[model samples]
Target: MESEIGAFVAVATVLTITPGLDTTLVLRAAASQGTRNAYATVFGISVGVLCWGLAAAVGASAILAASPTAYTVLCVAGAAYLIWLGIGMLRRARNRGRIAQTSGTARMGSTSAAESALRSWSRGFFSNLLNPRFGLFYMAMLPQFIPDDAPHFLMGLLLALIHNAIDVIWFSLLILGVRLMGHWLNKPVVQRGLDSIAGGVVIIFGVKLIIPVIFS
Candidate 1:
């Protein structure tokens, strides 16, 4: 079990570090908002991961993985969401000049602290939730690590928690790295560039998600 866990940790670490939708979202949050909101996003993402993990443990994820109809439905929904989010980011980048002036006032406006955090959190949560890949990944990977004699559900949950923990650590490091460069990263031009790149990546992921469904 320990060796299996060690191998799982090694694999999860590599997967977590690879740039993905979550990475783009966190980087954009840190650069555009601050560490506080960025962490909120992280928490939201973690919760989403845990939910998927739970689903996998209970055999819920297998339904989506095995059922082409269900998977395609989720794939399309997730793709639409990603494209929508990406378009919003691109618009923000285009209007970054205006954003520089209006952003502060907007933050100070009726948007309360709770509201702000909820918005950021939701952004991360839904981004993860709507994607079927997480469900598929958790279902496929967790079984590989579970020992023959162990309880499947509990073991799957444990593995998922481990993956989530690693994700939190890696994302926190990314937030810190962005904070260290806050001075320049927050600049209007830099923010614009980051938004553009992030937006493109998001849209690409969305397109990738739906392309197979479309052609199949």
Candidate 2:
């Protein structure tokens, strides 16, 4: 049990730090909306982990893994979702640097904090959920660590806890880093540039996800 727990921590740490859609979404949200919004995004994303963990524990992920056709279908669906999201982000980038202001003054409070948090949560949830790799990650990786004698439910839950805790810590630090940008984070030009980069990266991820499924 002790060895298993240690292994779970090590695996979770590596996986959480691995660059992925979730990381990008959280960081981008933080840059755009500051720390509070970023935290909300992290919270939503953590919920996603909870879902995945539960699914994994109950053998739901295993079913998907065992059925090649179903797995492929889901992978393709996830890729399509990412492409759609990337397109939307790119479109938003068109107006990224052009915050409406009164005369020459910037309207600091055009959007409320509540709205920002909601938007961040949306970004985080969709970003985490639609990343096809996430499902595969659990499907491929989690089983490797579980002993045949280990209780599946207990192991899965523990693994999920470790994964989410690591992710929360990593993302929190990122939000803190972006918060350091402070007032400069409000600059429309910087935000727009970030949107453009994020859009392109997400599109590339979508393309990457599709190519394999199509060819395979």
- Off by more than 4 A, model 1: 100-111
Shift of residue 84 alpha carbon in model 1, Å? 0.7
lDDT of 1 by residue, 1-216 (tens): 999999999988998899999999988888887777788888888888888888887889989968999999999999999999999999988987775454342122445667777777888998899999888998888778889998988987888789889988999999889878877775678878888999999999999999999999
- Model 2 poorest 10 in a row by lDDT: 101-110
Best by TM-score: 1
Clash totals for all models, in order?
Answer: 0, 0
Q: How much is 48 displaced in model 1, in angstroms?
A: 1.5
Give the whole-model CA lDDT for all candidates, comma-separated: 0.85, 0.74
Q: Where does candidate 2 stray beyond 4 Å? A: 101-116, 147-149
Q: Look at candidate 2 and give me any clashing residue pairs.
A: none
